[model samples]
Target: MLKDRNITLTVPAMPEYVDLVRLTLYGIASKMKFTFEDIEDMKVAVSEACNNAVLHAYDKDDGTIEVRFAFVKDELSITVRDYGSSFTIEENKETPAMHGKSIDEIQSGGLGLYLMQALMDRVEVEHGGGTAVTLTKKRQRTEEPA
Candidate 1:
């Protein structure tokens, strides 16, 4: 059977809240039966998304960052939204290729997005006047012996 839960939270675009989000994710993912490693990965990915919203989206701290979490069946879905200019994923991927380059030579941002994508099962981004990132991860299953 499939189970679903949804939650939305608004946080000031500040760095401190990143830990709060990570803690919340740990609690939720733990309840959802995520392994310790999986929970850690989720925490990292969620933190990156929240940090991106705060740093890139609301750079001026003039707006709020919205985060939504949905747990369905063995999958957890997360959405982070911000009312700021959108970014292009393709444009960001170019940064990783500049190996051994100085910080100035390398792109300043979007590395988090790449890390999030690598950790999560799925990562989708929608851009407009606002940006939304949707992330999904499936729980691992174990069989019990009779």
Candidate 2:
């Protein structure tokens, strides 16, 4: 069995730095034999997490975002952490009803969480002094559709 491996990257909470996190994810996930489509999904999810930290976690540009990539038992878990602000997520509770609302009626926030949950196999958030969003994707050995 392959031993669990981890890679940690810390970047300034800026839009420009998000790409570096994606690049690092691509390298590690590719090495673990992730399919291109899956890798792309992961990249988008990770970017959203990093973007959230950059936009909401700090008052200015001094804060940093820490991304941790942990590979264990054929699963890749990526955690994006920010130490600036914190939020809460009550378990097993649905968000405010957005159903049947016009596109203009919906707000611009909280969509990143939805997007991240849709892309990854599992998404978890923890916050007290900071927020850490952990996105997990499991590796599968299957042929990609042509």
Candidate 3:
């Protein structure tokens, strides 16, 4: 069994709520002692994920986006999920990773996934009845002088 700090948030699938998600992550990143640059990167990645869910997830205004943040030793894992349409990977998969294709080649729409994979250490997209994007980033470890 694994024990870690976790936070979960759910909001209506609307563009207006994207910023709220960003701000929440910003606070969590800061609390976890992430550098300013890393926090900014997380904000961008999370906002993009949230925006995508809000824009493309549902046809009707009756869906919710669930975001969860898990903090483990030296790593933070973020998961964004939408109970709407599922996501499909583009065909031009040059690299093993979905984000391996160039921005132009991955013409599904938007630079969101690209940015998330670029900024985070690991990115994974899972589809079941809904779509979930998981982003993970490892924090820098400082050596204490003896």
Give the best candidate by TM-score.
Answer: 1
For model 3, what is the error of residue 73's alpha carbon versus the real structure, in angstroms, after optimal superposition?
1.1
Worst 10 residues of 3 by lDDT: 91-100
Tell me each candidate's TM-score: 0.88, 0.86, 0.82
lDDT of 2 by residue, 50-146 (tens): 9989998999999999999999877999999999887665532446678999988887767788899999999999987789999999998787699
Model 1 per-residue lDDT tens digits across residues 13-79: 7898878778777878888889999898888888888888887776587777788889988999989
Each candidate: what lDDT? 0.83, 0.90, 0.84
lDDT of 3 by residue, 1-146 (tens): 12388999999998888888888888887778888988888888888888888888899889999999999877888899998987677732433454567876655545678888899999999989789999999887767899
Identify the runs in model 3 with alpha carbons over 4 angstroms from their true place. Answer: 1-3, 91-108, 143-146
User: Using alpha carbons, what is the TM-score of model 1?
Assistant: 0.88
> RMSD per prediction, one decimal?
2.3, 3.5, 5.0
- Residue pairs of candidate 2 with colliding backbone atoms: none
Model 3, C-alpha of 62: deviation from truth (Å): 1.6
